[model samples]
Target chain A: MGIAWFVVLSAFIFCIGAAGVLTRRNPLVILLCLELMLNAGNLALLSFARAYGNGDGQVFALIVMVVAACEVVIGLGLIVAMYRNKLAIDADEMSGLRG
Target chain B: MIFEQILFFVAAAGAIGGAVGVVVLRNPFFSVLALVGHLLALAVLFLLLRAEFVAAAQVVVYAGAVMVLYVFVVAYIGGIEEPIGPSAGPLRVLGPLFAGVLLVEIAIATIGSGLRAVSSTGPAVADDFGSPEAIGALLLQKFLIAFEAASFLLLIAAVAAVVLAQRRRGLEEAGGETPLQIGRRPPTGPQAEDPAAAGSGGPAGRAIDERTPTVAQGS
Candidate 1:
């Protein structure tokens, strides 16, 4: 029962992140979407970790959380510096990164 | 089955609603608030699943610490101002969808592989999960590498923040100077007099004196 609820909720959140990445032009929004995706990952991991008797999944989830934090700080700082150089935080504005 | 299932559905609904609010809301402040609410409800759901330690950690780390950092950053940035178009490119959206599909597929496979685990017919203590004690033992012993890595990662993040902030215009880090630096150097007596009290000596000196950056430059 809980697994079903977790799966459905996780799926919905995952879709939002998907839609955000598909829709947002701003880099910060993209970053937010990325975080949303990571959060969904954590939900799924913890849910399975609980359903099963093993604690390994929960430990893995913790590691992911730490990694996500590092990603956010560096990503945000990069965005801020980019905005300073270009005066905009829009992902589309960063054509220099495009091939 | 009935009451437990109902409570689970309610919390699930709250979680989903908050998750939607995070994306659909115009203000990221409200979005972050919604995210906090979502994480809290999710932690409750974790408790219902009997994962007490994970639930507590979710509240402490995710809901408390991580969300606080996010709110601080959002407040510092103020608002998105220019407004993100609608979303990013389609490829970005595809990434999350792939994860969703992968999760669904895995769930299906897991359930099909063994109905016994998902049945919930017997007591949940079916296994000697020993979750709390096991987690503590692993934290202190087996996974000490990861525990150490997390702390090291946080330290690096703090240093990076300090360095980046220091590099910003007008702000400096250690061994840097400010206009206030002039006041801190060894005093040369009269020149070291407080600017606030210096030009207030005479009535006329007080007249046009404080208005200008300098006064009585002539010999």
Candidate 2:
């Protein structure tokens, strides 16, 4: 029952996050949305782990946590430098590479 | 059924609302905050599922670290005031259309999956792997290689950031400038008041030689 409830909740959150990533122009917001989706994945994995009485899902979630850390750190470092150079964070204004 | 439906509804609302906030909010900082809220709700949901460790990981890593990095950069870039428009034609239409499709897809998939779960006859109960000890064993025993690989990836990312920063235009230019040049304190002696600095620089600029090192110190 408990795991069942969590599965539903995470799914819902995941959907919302995916939508945000699609609609928002801000790169930072898009990153946040991506994080939300990842959390949803972690949730689903955790629920399954609990339901089947296994530790693998939790371990997978830990790996995911580390990956998430790496992603954000790198992502933010790039964003910081980009913002400093260009004076803007809007994805649209970045036309140096655009055709 | 009745109680589960209610909890599900609350979770869905919180998730959807935060998601909407992430999209609709103009300020990236606010969007990040909404994302934190969304992640928190999902973490609690994970706890409800008996995956206590995953829930904690979600909070510490996603909500705590990832989000802080996001918010900090957003604040640093607060001065970025572009007209704030979509990049291309496709992006303008693409954004809303993608969001709409995702919403519809989630609804259908949720229903389909629930039906499947209800009919399945797999393990009647989940396991203790959601516990910290069980997770540790699985990570160290079965998935150690993958674990090491992820660490290697992190190292690569760190190196890449450094490389990218060094190669970037501003960084390249900044690197060429000495501490004195950066703070507008031109070189002293014969080069002290270079002709270009004397012509382009104002009184304050002319007074900066001794102050360059001090300003760098302050910075």
Candidate 3:
């Protein structure tokens, strides 16, 4: 497997995730897209680590996983709170902070 | 060698296809399912790259734990039933336009470099290079501070999540509106005398009460 192919694949996945974040109205879907992007980045890191014959990249991917988990927790909490307050989950409706 | 290439292509197709499914699918629940597929495909790709530890972590932490959190939150929010509406105005054109530009740029950069011929046949990796033990040793030794910090970050996130999601009695007692005030008003009228009538008043209120019992039963 060539490293470049993995890089291109990851870049493609990242773009898809970015598009989802931009176009999707649901906050939960947006969060899922964010996770998708993170995963793509991790894939690239692992591919490079394999090419370089090192373990640091895998370790870094693990750390990224930990951070991503924490982020999801906080994001879900916020989404739940938002649902409680507004009785709506539409991202467009959450314009209270938009200046 | 050819077998690895075939596996890589399959995994790549799966990863990319799943990501497209996540974006194009209307329902958020279905979108999450697509993400799970995407993560699993990526894990397979990681394995193909010889990063077994990373692959396991990807499946365990992401597809297992993080996805469970997502599914739980989706269920909690009662599942977004309505299909997502089309983006309004310039966003409809601009969002895809920008994404297309990004994809084009990346494709150009990747294809122009002539890097595709460079196979991942670097030096012979140690048998333990990408194994769990090697990753753990590296994490606890070179990245020890980061390891501890990640643990600390998780602790803070757990505390913060609890605080954010907690139903605060103080706010309700102070006449301030709690976010989850579906049935915050005192039971008035004849419903006050009839406990059962009050219980079925608002769907949100009923859902809140139901959640507790289901959670208790789950545990």
* Highest TM-score against the true fold, candidate: 3
What's the best-to-worst order under TM-score?
Answer: 3, 2, 1
DockQ for model 3?
A: 0.60
Off by over 4 Å in 1: A83-86, A97-99, B81-123, B126-132, B169-219
lDDT of 1 by residue, B1-219 (tens): 798778888888888787777766767777778888888888777766666777788889878887787777777677775453324466555655665676577656655655454444224553435367877787778899999988899889878866665565644333366544564332323323555444443245332423343354311
Model 3 over residues B1-219: C-alpha lDDT tens digits?
999889888988989889999888877788889889989999899887788888888888889988988888888887776565454767767777788899999888767765433354555787877888888889889999999999999999999999888754344565655533645434343244554555465356444644444334435
- By lDDT: ranked, best first: 3, 1, 2
Q: Which 10 successive residues of model 1 chain A have the least lDDT summed?
A: A81-90
Stretches of candidate 2 above 4 Å error? A2-11, A95-99, B1-12, B79-90, B113-127, B164-219
lDDT of 1 at A89: 63
iRMS (Å) per candidate: 3.7, 3.6, 1.8
Q: If scored against the real structure, what TM-score would every candidate get? A: 0.69, 0.71, 0.81
Native contact fraction, candidates in order? 0.25, 0.52, 0.79
lDDT of 2 by residue, B1-219 (tens): 577557656765776677667766777777778888877776766665566777787788778877777767877777233233465577667766775677577656655674444323225444563678766777788999988898898899889778766657665677778664755433433233454443343346555655464444435
Give Cα-based local distance difference scores for all models. 0.68, 0.67, 0.80
